[model samples]
Target: MRLTRPFRRLGPAERRIWDAYPTGAWVDLRTGDKDTDDPVNGPAWGPDRTVRAEVIAALLLGAREPEPGRTAGLRLAGARVTGELNLSDAVLTGKLHLLNCHLSEVVSLTDATTSGVRFRGCEMERIRAARCTVNGLLELDGSTVRNGVRLDNAHVTGQFRLSRARLHAPGERFRASESWLEDARRPFTAAEMKERGLGQDQWAVWAGGLTVDGGAFLRDLRVTGGLRLIGAKFHGGIYLQRSVITATGSHAVQADFMEAGAVEFSAGFTAKGTIRMRSARVNGVLSFSEATLEAPGRTLHLSHAQVEELIWLPTSVKGGVNLGYSRIGVLFDGPASYPDEVRLNGLTYEALRGRWTVAERLSWVCRDSDGYRPQPYEQLAAWFRRIGHEPDARRVLLAKQRRRRGTLRPTGRFWGRLLDLVVGYGYRPWLAGLWVVVLLAAGTAVFAAVPPAQIDPDEVRSFQPFVYTLDLLVPVSVFEQRGAWEPVDWTQWLAWTLVASGWILATALIAGAARVLRPSAGS
Candidate 1:
């Protein structure tokens, strides 16, 4: 009978020799037994020769050891491997690397690590580890470290430093959520220090949930994406001086529900994003001296929060510092008000314009306070005397005197009645003069209307024409009524003449007194 192709190709002994070792190793079984088992313990191969997948798997999985004193370079990419593979204390001088190695099946590198396991310039598609651990410093400094650098629910019992590392993928995320960086207590010496960019061109360190209880040091780091510190707690001061944050999210450095001792951003810190301190309680001062915020849409919103101490903005703040509805314990008085809250000494309206409202408000308050001062009344009286507004000034003085004497009552009704009489008669001096003139004219007319006694008229009827006219003007019945002729009872005429003279004198006195006492225009 003719054998089948695969069965006839390999005999029974050859099949038994092939089944002796693991499935992905490449070695000749007929060469030697010791050589077949230790096939990777050999010299290096050139770049043209293909490295068998079985040998590469055995070497990486620690099932076979590479030869000493000879440097070997192997690239196991796109190879399907199963079960746990450990590559601890392996020395590959010329780049022992893995690219798109499908290890979706069960794979563990627990306590199996390398010195410079550089995935520096390659892309790690997806790596899922259950409880895998690394025991050395894994340096991926200048690499496109991508896609969930997550060691979720795992333990890293060594120093894990990824300084100056970049995240390439769009939503590149990292979460060492519950794990701790234990060896972070060791101080970073000068040689171990990482250089910082002066915000020229660099990406920020993006880590989803980073917890360093032993105090992580990120002195002058830069970030191009959002840093979410959601439900994180730190016991150290987060020094972010001279750091540039260009996060696209709401908050550049969000510590939503965090408890920190102190957060200091002293020297030349800048944020091109909104720093939200919503529902966060800071025990100390949130000082931002010499710091600049250049947010595009809405610059630096600190709306609803409670600051226990002071929120200082002392340095040159470029954008609008909005403390619109925030509550401050003590706001220091601005430069204008030095001593008293009421008095604004040396206040100038021209100096303060469009800068601060406090200056203008204080100036207005000072002017109002000085306007009601009692000294203005005296000063106005003196000014009126100097500037020829004396009449108005005297009126003001009289009004002020009346206002001052408003509470005092008059001593007697006699004085009150005298004042009323004086005021009523004082303004009418011409009326008194006219009354005297009328009384004199009436007396003269009455004397001419009545004639002298008739017996005297017959005895001295001398014809002086002026005297005869005077006699004719007088009436004949005047002497008969009086029973006398020579004097004709001149007492009644003398009494009328005396009353008119007295009234004329009184009118002259009244007019003189009114002219002297009245307020002059230049008073």
Candidate 2:
């Protein structure tokens, strides 16, 4: 509400106003009038009084302590401050609205506590608000900050609106270089530099480590350079609904270990670099529904995060979505292409959004290249069971069994592949029936071609080749046909093969039935 000591008797700030446009008049905060005389805005054609930055700040801080609704805060519009505007460590009880003001130097609100601050339609060089606390909304709507905007360690009680705000922080763009291992080559992956914490924060708009109690509304934000929000935490939902961040380096939105309720990177979010949200925890839905990411590999990495609600990643993803060891409630949907490379090693999603076949779901689960990871499969099966999709759950278990078999030793692999090839790990019961029919037909042909000596001559009235073949296949019962014939020479081999086929078919049918009825043990 009041300027403490040094800022109390602040000198007058200076600015020269031009007479070209309607807003081109020198506005003096001291006399509270527009002056058209001191001359420094332009050349001889300029007619404007010069104003100091401190003069503006001192006048805005008020001659006395600001009252509630009377003169609580500063509301200065279209006033150009020629020097650096320093409001650091100041306390303001009311909102500060600086509209359409142009400052030549950076504005420092470091460690300042204010109710709210709106720099709507203003253009400043830069902003340094480290450790500043805003009780209400901080609106940077339609403003242009040429240099970096640092809000590190700041806390906002209400929403932080950066909609239509143009923040410029030059990032290191990729250049065509010959060296592969050198630092001046292509983009350095965020994985390589995240440990050192040099990711996109050096020369960009860094709000890293800030905590917003309310939601962050950042729609249509165009950061020309890199934007880093590493370690930022939001208590309520954060909506970056439509923002285009084009960082040159590997890490564009370096929001590692962030904690938020619900986050929406939906609608028209195009990022050129990697949007790393690794080790972050989301309490609600983390939606990247309509984003266009140009990730080369694991660019959309959200590894080790715990998402309590749904996570939707539809539309465009040009790289891998690494969700290794993350716990998610439900996966609403995801990208189609490169699904096999999606890092879902230890993902735990309860239920999916859409109704997908068991095969489709298993196919996605099998995308991990580590052969057979039991936890993912078990998690999926448990989720399916919880949702009353028992049959699909069995299919998932069967898929896991087959995959596990594939990863086993030589003998186990052989049997696993054989079972998979024959009956889809005992999930497709009809395949076993088809194999039975095939073996029956094959046996019938061989038996009718080469007739054997009749072991039971009186049973000739029921000597049907097809019936005899089927009777040999069903191990549970027998007909008066197996002992009726004895094959000779090459036909003996055919009979033995038919017997083996019958055993395989019967075993497959029983195994399939058991698998369908029983729940998967591992998960």
Residue pairs with backbone atoms closer than 3 Å in model 1 (clashes):
24-54, 25-54, 204-223, 450-475, 451-475
Write candidate 1's Cα lDDT for 333-416 as tens digits: 233322122222221111121233423432323332333322223333444456576654454443333333333367533432
Q: Encode model 2's per-residue lDDT on 167-279: one tens digit a residue.
A: 76633333222221234135446774554234543346788889999888888888755667778898887887778876545555778889898888888877766778888
| Candidates in order: C-alpha RMSD to true structure | 28.5, 6.7
lDDT of every predicted structure (CA atoms): 0.37, 0.69
TM-score for each of the candidates? 0.32, 0.75
- For model 2, the stretches where C-alpha displacement exceeds 4 angstroms are 1-50, 56-63, 67-69, 170-203, 308-315, 334-340, 354-363, 366-410, 437-486, 506-518, 521-523
Best by TM-score: 2
Lowest lDDT 10-mer window, candidate 2? 15-24
lDDT (Cα) of model 2: 0.69
